[model samples]
Target chain A: MAPYETDDSTRAEDADDLRAGPRRSARYVVPVAVVGVAAATIGLVPALADSGNPDLPKITAQQLIEKIAKSDVQQMSGTVKITTDLGLPNLGGLQNSMASAAPRGGSGSSADPSSKLMELASGTHTVRVATDGQDRQKLSLVESAAEYSLIHDGKDVWGYDSASDQVFHSTAAQDGGKRHDPAPATPKDFADQALKAAGDTTSVTVGGTAQVAGRDAYKLVVKPKQSGSTVGAVTIAVDAKTGMPLKFTLTPASGGAAVVDAGFTKISYARPAASTFRFTPPKGAKVTEEKDGAHGDHRHPKGAGPSSHGLLPGMPGEKGAKGGRKVIGKGWNSIAVLDTGSKGGTPSASGAKGLGGMLGSLGDPVSGKFGKGTVFSTRLINALMMNDGKIYVGAVTKDALVKAADTGH
Target chain B: MSRADPETEGTARTARPAADTGPVTEPAGAGRAPSPLRTLGLLRSELSTTFRRWRTLALLAVLAAVPVLVGIAVRIQTGDGQQSGRGGGGGPAFLTQVTHNGLFLVFTALAATLPFFLPLAVGVVAGDAVAGEANAGTLRYLLVAPAGRTRLLVVKYATTTAFCLVATLVVALSALAVGALLFPLGDLMTISGTRITFADGLGRALLIALAVAVSLTGLAALGLFVSTLTNSGVAAMATTVGLLITVQITDQLPQLHAIQPYLFPHYWLSFADLMRDPVYWDDLVKNLQLQALYAAVFGSAAWARFTTKDVTA
Candidate 1:
């Protein structure tokens, strides 16, 4: 009805109303049909892949180590941007990027441990730390957690919470793995749990090349041998030649993209103290006093059944029986994460709580209290021999534990 | 120039029924049919005109784009304990926490739009509601006929409401599209750590959209009120736009935080709280009530103003 529009229409010779017939239907129909067909193909990609082998790779401990030692250095250590998605007491989860982001202290435990606890009178407790030194892990100790130091000159592994100035000590022996502490439980945990677990030569295949940290990096895919959630396939950037891991990436087995990157800064390769490698408690530390007894003296609790191998009711029976002496039984209270094959994760105040929760939920370490501690009990199997094997671990005390290790029964 | 040759018409030959006329029963099929609904019909026509313009179409297209972008953003966010360049740390737990904080985004978007852009778009439609008729010289003819001020006010409100609906839909759809693409679609973990599935997500999105629609009611009523205040389309638009910004600035000041929640647009975003595992219906109900109260008060004022105002322009 605008004057100019009407005038333009009049000047067009008003050609036989091209939109008057069947052509009108065809005009809109053809474009819509073409678009619909194109869209269908784009949605079919995931369905097209063969269900079984998605060309996944396998990883091993040694392989994990070599991948990290790529850039051999004498000294390195720095702040690592760490985020543990499966939320712990103070951890983040799938929505991490969108919400409260907490920075932690990992003197070398995980940021937030699965479980951590301690009794002050005994100064004996367990803890986990972040792979990086960032997270607060204190709940596990009794008295001065003040001596918390993974690189102990002669002390129990512990960390200092500067905010509260509380010194927390770990109960578990500082094994070379991350525990329920933000600080490194041991150098090995930081180097191996992720770097070592993922750092591999044979296990990692070069996917392609890309730039990472402003340096040339190789896109290497590191797949967990048994993929499917609990243990998932991950990818990392490796310095092609030196094999130094530059960045770590994770892609959940269940579909969804957006691989998060955790970059490492300031690292050290200096040899840990001679005392750190040795497991010896400090003087006056009231650790468990082991009684002297022959390995053969220890035995399984009376009336214990084969199904008692510390497995969730539905889980498979111990692979230990086959190896006879194999220590292959599941740790009901010990969620032996295959990801790191280390004890329930880094120990912190709640490290024990975290692993215990996961284990309690996933396995069968039905809750019970032992002493003042919430002791999550499960069958402990004897060391399973790779060659000639026998099974005998659940017994009374340490002598039997050693004898069982040597005698295999 | 025949009968239409009126570049310089004789002193008194016009379309009016001389001096005193009841209603000119113009013949149909003769010309433009007297714009059918008369005053109300003209108001309706005035609103649709904005949608026909390129800027409105462009806004709609932009609205459609939000969903995809949101999806992408959710997908690429960092999940590990730490975040990298240009991104925040993200994870399953964090995602749930953010959902609990849903109302924040709603309030932010509402406040953001009221400032310059959204109100401008609204004014483009509302300002034109009356001044446009005058500009087109349709007002003189309309007043000479049956269109009284009452019918005109109602028609203008209806058209403005329609534009508001379309704009709100644009914002909601865009947010949803982006959220779906960026985040996992199956389940949403809540701040409390409980998991709610997509069924809940979809349901929540709907409530949120409705809440957004509710928020717009205030703006719509404001637009209509402004439209009735002046005959100039641009002036009415500037006035409303200025008021929106002033309110937004005041709402953000820490000193004003205590009373901010009482503002009409304050509770509009509470709809997002619906997506939480234990959906906080309390805030949502409060939001709706507040918005309703705002709409009622503003609508009444607009109604009164338009009904009493002289339309000599």
Candidate 2:
């Protein structure tokens, strides 16, 4: 160590010389080194945390499918994180438009199950889900400061929004406990959708093993054989022990980030407390009860429940369209054409107008033998809403949507 | 200006005698390993000096008043019976709940201020930590008091961190008071729509406040580094605050989403997770880790600059 200098002028000169020397430059090396270490840690931690693919006993795709079908481990609770990147521009603006255009009286309220489904279409959502048996379940959409919870306990279904202090409740008609409102899609629900599509039109292959939510899992990769499908492949991580799907990822043909990725960050096979499914409206909460069969018609204006695809409702081969809804083409290339105002009542008519306006602003105008319409295209789904009140929607290109419309199915 | 030379030289010579006498005579113990007791005394004095300033008090007072304003405004809005239409569609998180339970004001205020007000106050105090002393020419006297540069820098950072805690508590306590006074307090609702007892709500509020204070420590360290870079207190403060605003704006821009998570302010609102029924540790842990990273990087930079540079002031 250098001796302390008493003379001011000499010490000042020494300071200036030090500033010009290598020692001054060397002093900065510590912070630079720290930053370098931080960057390295940031890059390495995720890589290390991944721990690569877990090794498991090889199983055929058919065997894995059978495993999922036969394995019955019910009553579980977990935190599911769902991320959707559909290449939509300005999602905040889109949400604002949807909120403003949403009908206040009927199915557009914040507590409405369908509106809740709309909220899940974009951005990342954390959902706390607990299910006990087939009839009782709970799903809570956790936001930063607010929560929307849907609790189904036997015949009674309750939806509560903490922020609004509003509750939507309905009693299931005694027709063997059929739930009208769709629960938020868990990995299991998405896996079911992917597996349902795994027929002759798709090739199911075992893609090795994975560790999901700290559990050993087998990865099932399902790829569409038809080139017309926008979905390149769907991968589901099935728990080796329980056969429950722990993660579901859908990659687009264009190939960037997965368009739909739903995975459990934490899970427990232990049955959730029965009290978790029970709900009583808080004091001062505005409770609205839906009459039997009324919620189903207005809530699902497109005649398809959110459970059909877990994201965009009425995807290819969705059943239960009552009237004016037709499926054109076959398998992955199929397009669903709906006559919006035909049997949808006044609320649906108004909703279609607002939706048409919103989609018109978001999409590009196209014209062909199908006449003029706005073609709203995402990475995976293209929706062409014609001026004649018919909507042609499918997981295909804009040209395919136009061709589907021209077929006039 | 001409007398500065002799004055600095005189202080330097005087400091040597103090160093020879050891830790017994000087609290800062120049030229020797700093004693823990005297270092604590130095820290105490530094904290007193920082908190006693009218500027600090004014910043705190402003922070304390924000929750009151928000609470009263919300009270007035709900009093009009027009809240039904608005629901929880807009505004900061937990704003809608303040009308039902006053305890929510704490969460609302913290969320309201975490992005800007709280960090701005932290910037002001931290940016002035060392630069203000130098600008007043008290730094030379303190150093000549045989306060080693490293110890002084450490004391300065400690003082800034104390301010961060004090500032956050001021906001939280004020919100709690205003909330209790304005709205009915009872069982609180978690973000998961589950009910929690009032005592549990109060405990969570404290944890949230602590989390908020922890979040600002990174910015405090960055500000302290900026303070060491210049002798002008106002310049340092301005630069720190300006950097804060720029980072916040960049964090919000969609184009910069790739780099937004790396920014210090990115996960500050993860404090809201404490209000969840089963607290989500993912973002909260990330926030803590990110703050630790920033603190380490900037803290070392401040130490390097303060120790190596000549303190002619």
User: TM-score winner among the candidates?
Assistant: 2
Each prediction's Cα lDDT score? 0.39, 0.77
As for model 1, its CA RMSD to the true structure in angstroms is 21.2
Q: Which candidate number has the best lDDT?
A: 2
Cα lDDT tens digits, model 1, A210-254, are: 554334555556554431112233566654444556556544444
lDDT of 2: 0.77
Off by over 4 Å in 1: A1-409, B1-47, B66-120, B131-147, B175-184, B190-192
**Candidate 2 residues B1-313, lDDT tens each?**
1211211232343233334334234343334543566678889999898889999999999999999999988888778655546765667788877877899999999988898999999999999988988899887777655545666788889989999999999999999999999989998777666678899999999999999999999999999999999999999999999999999999989899999999999999899889876787889999999999899889989977876677778
Give lDDT tens digits, candidate 1, residues B6-65.
Answer: 112222212212211211232421333333345445665656666787867886676555
Q: What docking grade does candidate 2 earn?
A: acceptable
Error of 1 at B205 (Å): 1.0
For model 2, residues A1-409, the per-residue Cα lDDT tens digits are 1243342332433354375577665667777998999899889998898997887888999999999998786688999999988776554664565554553544445676655655676778988888788798788898766778888889888888877767888776667875554733688877876777766888899999989999999999988888777888889999998899999998988899998899999999898876577676766667777755666553443312112233644234343243456677776777766677575443333444555664567789999997898887777777788887877777877887887788783
